[model samples]
Target: MRLLLVEDDHMIGEAVQELLRAESHAVDWVPDGNQADAALLAQRYDLVLLDLGLPGRDGLQVLRALRARHDRTPVLITTARDAVAQRVQGLDAGADDYLLKPYDLDELLARIRALARRAGGHSDEAYACGEVWLNPVTRQATLRGQPVQLSGREWAVLLPLLARPGAVLSRAQLEDKLYGWGEEISSNAVEVYIHGLRKKLGADVITTVRGLGYMLACQPAP
Candidate 1:
């Protein structure tokens, strides 16, 4: 999904951004609290990966502002080892998840997905649509009992559609959940990934709507 990453360490920031981009997420990376606050105030994003130690406004201040405004956007705080207490404070301040410094990219992405799954607090991690099964935690997909390995972006592309089952997601709507900062997107990148998913998941599984976006052939389990 499109996320705002507020981190200062250029190396870590760049590495994390690249990793998330490889997952096909559109990310907007900003350093310091001012840029982060402005972005939070002026725009909407699927999720926010916030670093607790920030210059100017401080991460807690930013979280407080967001909560005070009842923004309710899902925020995942990045904290340090000694600051375990800050994790609780961050959550209490309105963060949806927490990531300690020196975390695995896999863990970070999983944390992001877990929080986004709570966008409306829909916490079902395993989704089944027809013969397709997706594991958000592992980023694994299986169709008709066959394993499918998806690139990070491809997973980013497919998860939202799977999340909504049969709901139709327009290109722009889906794009909102598919990208991160400094990640290059092809005009047809989404299509390319979707096409690949269709091939692997079976053409009958994903249907296109002419000029519109695609939809998965899934119905929620009762």
Candidate 2:
């Protein structure tokens, strides 16, 4: 999943970014609230990890602005403020979940997974298409019940395709899913990943739309 982390503390932000990247998530880390607001407005993210004590606007102000614009992107507040009133204010301002600073990293990741699942309307962690199955949390894939090895970039390309089988996604759309802010893209990165996926999952698993892009050959099982 792609995530935007709005945190001013370099230590906390870098730690969180590293953890999420280890879990195969593309993350864009920004310090200060104004940059956060601008990033929020500029790009799409699966989740936002916001810190309240921010430079040039504060997290609550950013949250309110997002809500005012009716942006329902799930937000998980990661702030040092622990007071009940502050928590209430944050939630009322439109935070989906709140985590106090000095919290458990495991819990933080769990919360992130929960918010992502909720946003995607997923009842289960596993995504399946025909004989291929992918567990995002585990960053694992299987074909016909056997384990299928996939690289980080390969998983990035495959996840969105698996999520919406049969729906054509343009190269630009897939690139958006594959790369995050400030990340450079190669000319044929999408095609390269698609070719790799086809080699592993089978040549017929992905259907090319020529000028349009690509789509999955399998639909979710009923």
lDDT for each residue of candidate 1 in 107-132, tens digit (9 for 90 to 100): 89788877877784577777777777
Local accuracy of candidate 2 as per-residue lDDT tens digits, 1-222: 789999999998889988888776788999999999999999888899999999999999999999999999999999889999999999999999999989899899989988887888888998898899998777679999999999988987888888888899999988877667778889999999999999999999999998999999987865
Candidates' lDDT values, in order? 0.80, 0.90
Query: How many times do residue backbones clash in model 2?
Result: 0
Q: How close is candidate 2 to the true structure, as a TM-score?
A: 0.93
Tell me how candidate 1 scores on lDDT: 0.80
Hey, what RMSD does candidate 1 come out at?
2.5
Task: Point to the candidate with the largest lDDT.
Answer: 2
